[model samples]
Target: MGKRNITDEEIGLIKAMLKRGMRNDEAHFHFNRQDRLISPGRIAQIKSGKYGGDVAIANDTALDQFLAESQQRSGAPAKAARLSGPDWGETFEADGGGGFRVRGGETDTVECKLSFRMNPNRFAEVVKSIAGMANNKGGMIPFRGT
Candidate 1:
């Protein structure tokens, strides 16, 4: 039979199954039982990072790369599930933390929080910024460390 084109989500589930100590045959059988078309050999290939396809992932870095490529292919704006302070393309210096010191500072999407919440207004501003980010194409809200 022809190879089934699996979604990234399915690939993630397979990865999870592998992490849970399930063998390739077990994962294949599990999926097949759920009516999903995946083979034990294919599952092994995916885990070995030899799956010659777009959804290839070997580790965290590879997964990040795969997700970025997938997002780019879909022509959809990147969604932020965590704080990725800055992009590699951006001109900035790392402060040895999950933050950046941009040369020119905040852009249309990048926002900075310089201090802790001292009052209701400041807390409200932070909340609004988070909501704005979630509602938009998603972005990083870097908070300065004291």
Candidate 2:
């Protein structure tokens, strides 16, 4: 598939996000929406100064404004959960109630667990799954059950 092109303004925001202590994966999650795709690798390149080196970092005020605007656009609360898969293809957002809404089905980067048990076997499985995700591109696993 063709990758979405990122604009200079977005590059500035990415730089600012990194400078402000946001992880590359988290930055990728924030910027890579369903309609837009910013690869984690691209975020890494920006973090390492291999890309967007000429773009200026966005100011604090601009960053705040951008984040606010993003929340508004997504119709999410001030502290709603926003997550994406490794390919930056799918997005999961808070439903404003107590649940989350996902746009696509499970992928290599997105796993959904209907319930989570605290038993030793379940805990081991969860840890192994998380480690696998970390080894690959970062991913999100939202436990729906208590």
Candidate 3:
């Protein structure tokens, strides 16, 4: 199939995922389904009030509390911090495949993942799915054998 385009419907879904306090991995799944790119770093940017819309939500207090109090501790995801840079469109990875990231130079960027693997052909479908997500959120996939 041809590459999918981002829609208001999909962006709305992303907003829904945001309101639910989804962490990086979960958000990644949702973004894949919605055909929008997002990483733990982007998610964090949204939460921290930097990327996307200019008008900040009124419930900053709630967000602050959530970040400060969530007990589901997690390792810090890698970030490239290039969202506004010339190379902001790429996501990088390491040699070994423990963790991979989209974009960079920002904290908590694309965190959630589809978290599955398949044969080469099947993996293409997964890549297509993530490609749409990346189009919407803007990043590269660095996961090995992804």
Best by lDDT: 2
TM-score-best of 1 and 2: 2
Q: Write the per-residue lDDT of candidate 1 for residues 60-144, one digit (tens) a residue.
A: 5654565466546534344323334455335456756875665344433566665658597677887888886675446776655
Better of 1 and 3 by lDDT: 1
Q: Pick the candidate with the highest TM-score.
A: 2
- Distance (Å) between predicted and true CA of 86, model 1? 63
The per-candidate count of clashes, in order, stands at: 0, 0, 27
Scored by lDDT, model 3 comes in at: 0.46
By summed lDDT, the worst window of 10 consecutive residues in model 2 runs over 80-89
C-alpha positional error of residue 105 in candidate 2 after TM-score superposition, expressed in Å: 14
Cα RMSD of predicted structure 2: 9.4
lDDT of 3 by residue, 30-81 (tens): 3443345545465565555554444434354554443333322232233335
List all candidate RMSDs to the true structure. Answer: 14.4, 9.4, 12.9
- lDDT of candidate 2 over 25-112, digit per residue (tens): 7677667767876678999988887787888889999999998887666554544344545733345556678766655344446676
TM-score of each: 0.31, 0.54, 0.28
How far is 80's C-alpha from truth in model 3 (Å)?
Answer: 5.3
